[model samples]
Target: MSKGRILIRNGHVIDTEPQPVAHAHTDVLIEGGKITAVGRNLRSKGAMVIDATDRIVLPGFVDTHRHVWHSALRSAAIDIDLGAYFRLLGQVGPKFRPQDVRIATLAGALECLDAGITTQLDFAHIAYSPELANAAVDALKEAGLRAVFAYGTPVNVTAGGKLADVRRIRERLADDNALVTMAYAPLGPLSTPMETVARDWRIADELDLPLTIHLASSPNNEQPIFALREAGLLREKTLYVHANGIGDDELKLIADSGATASATPGDEAGRLRRAGITTGTGIDTVAFAPGDMFSTMRAAHLAGQIAEDPQLTAKDVLRMATLDGAAAMGLADRTGSLRPGKQADVILLRLDDLNMLTAERDPIGAVVTEAQPHNVDTVLVAGKVVKAGGRLVHADLRRTARALRATAAAISGR
Candidate 1:
């Protein structure tokens, strides 16, 4: 399919763009990979018509940060904290061959698509060699998911040693309009020298790529952003992941510098959002949490509700999973909403599903609070139907499952 026309008719449409709004019994028309119209009874001749009755039509979710290379190790470190998780990575990270990395990355991207995530920023830090880096990029391109492949230093490896490989991968993925783009993922001042961080930032700037970093996840790292600010490296096109445990002043600085923040489950995403920052939701690692945005949204909402302010509502988290997430990834102009001019990254959820049958009164709340990946009935990326009738349209699941199992066994030495 070469970005053909699509007409999704008569559904409950929800979108967060310009502003969050919902429309009932509306139609959305997509042509040449872009949404051309969104209204009642829209007509598009020769378009592939999809009946969306009893479905919730919305822009597909955007995951701002995910270590996609960890897919084969799902639940391996489920009970560990951040420190132990890194230690686990040090143990298993070196065991993965380039083929294994490709399998894990492809599996992870497919998982994202199955859960209605049309776009993701893959915080891929398993690129231990040039072969491994190329393999990971190959996997993303093969999976056909829109992604920002944020290349980074491997765990248990020397930080900033892979800058040249980052450039190489950037050169390979130079087409920004393609599904797979490139970014730089650096171990910020917390785990690397300021000099190394500067080098990483300069390489990223030279490549004209975005920079994403793990910052303020621990108390010792809470001040790394300030250091970046002092070094004059803090700027837009940067995503501060795990802005957890940071103070209001730091949040203000991030907001002022036009930088965005992303938080996994149980982080201060709500705080960042409240401080006028563009806070996106991240699955972070599937090693400990569900990969789907529905679970991530619920976790984020709970994190906010338990906070003193309790101002993060269900709709707010939905935005974090959608438009805000795209903004965090610096691709809001192309995706993140059902806006007429945006790319057609959309999904349909079966509102009549058992879990959502009676939740029509607050559809957005239902999506944020009650929906699950199983409720996703159809998905489209760039006007191409990748999923329909509650199943992936082009995936070879049996083959993928076999490869994943083999990769896991090989990695675990089982």
Candidate 2:
């Protein structure tokens, strides 16, 4: 049998444990993709040693909600309101062919990996054809990253065209279980018909796969929830993307159904800023952010405290972004904590960074309030070093960025 071991030495391990931070200087042992031990002075004879001195080791980030196809269009929709955003999705999203989707998805996934995100739930809604879906999935696999390709159906342009041959794709991916999982992403109520939504839910239920849908964005739009109820498809297996506009009845339904919510508080705050609205409307869903997990956690914490109770702590925010996100993606049992026997999806943050240093009194608060992507010094996924010393190790990012730019230009007719 093939054997390998990696020893990460002298790092401050922060595994989302409830106790008051122990083992300031310690080592972690990884053997065959799982963490075997975490403590001081680990036996490392014949194992590859990684110096982790002066670093803070924690579980790798799990991005619960992200549109990887929009990587090339980062901040491109900043000026557009919600309606214009939808217009762009309707008009320009379908213009992307399979190649475009491949380049964008690969680039986006690589970006997340380089920035310490180990698991990403990519809401790929640009499935104009089966070829497009296949290409998107291929891109994720090629990146050698852990990901969930939330395969979304095409919009109304193609009447009765299925997104992709789900059976064929499943068969192709069934054996290769290293880092990819597929899920159904039925475009929320606004873009997809209710009957079609029910059909998608049925397919997911039959396959025992998770279902993801966007809901509760605008306070004026209750149609998504209403449509789900009408179709009798709202259940525990469903993952509601956003609950920004969900009412008390909707929250109760979500809580009772045992379904999960993945909220992007930073994006919601950005949207609210752009539209000149209050940020409190979308506070109920599971909060998350792609580029900046700290901002998301802080925003969610403040929102929760302001709207509900003022005594909420920083741990609550951390749990929402870390553990809650993992649960929402059905990956809590495997990740979301620094437990032995689990995949070593982990990261090390440099606490000496300026933003992280000031709030030293509360390390969790410091991470939630001050730390940013730059503070992440190392990232590991499944016992492999993907990023170290703040740089990517697996793929050439400059090439990917150039390719993505060219593809975006072609699709946008620029």
Candidate 3:
């Protein structure tokens, strides 16, 4: 984690915390993989200088929930709905070997970095074996991205796959530091039996790892938030992903239990709408949802505005992508902000990009509104440059894409 001194000079910094936020023309000094200072004209001797002029420096985006393994299969689910996705993955997943997992993880991780997602909670369900699990972890390390490898318990929970296996993986990866962390990803309560879920939660509690589950809305099964509450299972480390249209009682219980929630609005909004257009359950959607976190932010903002409860400011909307997301992963102390003591996981987006030609004056507005991945000029993870000059470092984009296609072809027996 000891990335050497990096002096980012003369960039407008959107430091989202500790008052006096969003300074213009600020210099940031990073040392030993941590932010050392943020001020005007800061200098560090013998530091690697990065020209951040004409760029807006912000804490890199954090994605609270993502199935990163699918990076190898980009747009695979784009045309399909929730049911088709389940069917497709169910058929193709078993054919993937360890090498495939490694390639997919690395590709996915790079995609996140390229998109300016500095920290990601990668819900890795493909690692049914330890070798596969280690492969995913290794790829994350090699990608030099900050990630939480949310280890999923196996399909055959009756056999070798258990919390002990997770513990063993943790022991194997004991050397992993802040750059690559661990999490407990288990089948949600509605999917698995309550007894098994109870055991998994107990194991996660004993291990003191954050637990994330997809409490997705399904009419086929009765909502289980009340059941989880009755079972005394909710905790601060508990994160419910994409619990859209959840009842007020469930939301209140989740809040009272000190649990967190995350929304991958792209997947949810798209799935619902696509399902409506397709053969699956045509769930009603009030607003048209697109495929980015910005759309998610917009959805949340609109919801808050419509309710007249608490209208979100630009900062409030941005916090869901930054501090709140890190809090969901229990990583708020490290990588979420641009604090002096935090890890130097930062990104610079070019305000000079074509998308920004008609941009608003508010920095945070652009971040939560119009900024695209192509606008990412530079990205640093743990103070190391993983993306520079709007291109991913240490990557052969064309070759990687080709390899991914070959992988898909092999999987499909083409």
Candidate 4:
């Protein structure tokens, strides 16, 4: 794999370092690990040149919510809904050991990279031990993906034990600029005690790490927004996931605090708009929401349309999939978009492909509305070609898939 300097020439670039900057045809230079330049006809020696003639170059996707360690149970919970998910996870979650977590996290992270997602928040709600947490971090490091290993505290772990393990893991993976980093996946006030939640939130804040929690899903884990508000814990660094069915008051609370929301968006536009939230999109479960950020984007767009909100656009929806997502993961200053001095995490989408040939009139529209993972022809993480020519360059997917399959079989007694 070419892991050094790369110069991609002659691609239509969608550079959203913040606002969108579209270049009809330009050059982007990458040296070491950062984007050196983005312009027309740039020249640099010793850089491996990539001819992106028929490609659309954009910043790689940021997926804010994915239970990546559940890859071992891919088809295990697809048909189930919100209620069954909690019950099933309660039953099957304990079955996974450290080896299974490593395999699942590595394989799942590679799949996201292959799908043009350069950064992810792996909601690893399976960390039952310090060894398991370490294995999870090791898997992300080995996969060479930028990630937030959200430490999902096991039910059996005391609050003190949770903090201790998180401290150990964070110190071990102490590089704030490392490709793999740590985040707190607190159970929140709904599942965890209020005092414990406060303590955990304080720990995350003091560590300068991001915090992500399952948001106020109704009929079970409801009213979490108020609980968090009462404690004065809602802030910009916190990412509330699957923020469905939240009330207008809760929306005001979230929006006013400078916090952000992540939506899976099966049907969530009304609440999101009411909250006046700059909502980011995410793929939640391997059993359901795989590495399909495009689908989530489309769902968000449709939700806005369905709610009759006139402020939505396909391009802004695309922003949710990229820039806003980086904000949700608390990494906007690093890996979200194509800019000088930011990490070179980018993707080359094949606009010459069948589905895009006729629909390529509007690049952002085509990408948001029609393009799927199949159109992702190349992916780069930190200037390295992790996936090229529509395939992952650094992983043995078959071996990993086989191991997951075997693990699933044994767990099911099949």
Using lDDT as the measure, name the better of candidate 1 and candidate 4: 1
In candidate 2, residue 158 scores what lDDT?
A: 48
Model 4: clashing residue pairs?
none
Compared with the true structure, what per-residue lDDT tens digits does model 4 show for residues 63-146?
A: 888888877778777777867877777777778778878888888888888888899988887877888888788899999888
Query: For candidate 1, lDDT tens digit of each residue in 211-241?
Result: 8988763544558778888899879989988
Candidate models: Cα lDDT each: 0.88, 0.69, 0.72, 0.80
Model 3 residue runs over 4 Å out of place are 18-20, 153-160, 217-221, 266-311, 358-360
Residue 58 shift from truth in candidate 2, angstroms: 0.2
Give the worst 10-residue stretch by lDDT in candidate 1. Answer: 216-225
The lowest-lDDT stretch of 10 consecutive residues in candidate 2 is 278-287
Q: Where's the lowest-lDDT run of ten residues in candidate 3?
A: 277-286
TM agreement with the true structure for every prediction: 0.97, 0.86, 0.87, 0.94
Candidate 3 lDDT by residue in tens digits, 208-315: 778888775465336678778778787777877766666666666676777776755433323222222100011011112332455566665555455434454557
Clashes of each: 0, 3, 0, 0
Candidate 1 has what TM-score?
Answer: 0.97
Counting only residues 3 or more apart in sequence or on different chains, how many pairs clash (N, Cα, C under 3 Å) in candidate 3? Answer: 0
The per-prediction CA RMSD against the true structure, in angstroms, equals 1.4, 5.2, 5.9, 2.1
Of 1 and 2, which scores higher on TM-score? 1
TM-score between model 2 and native: 0.86
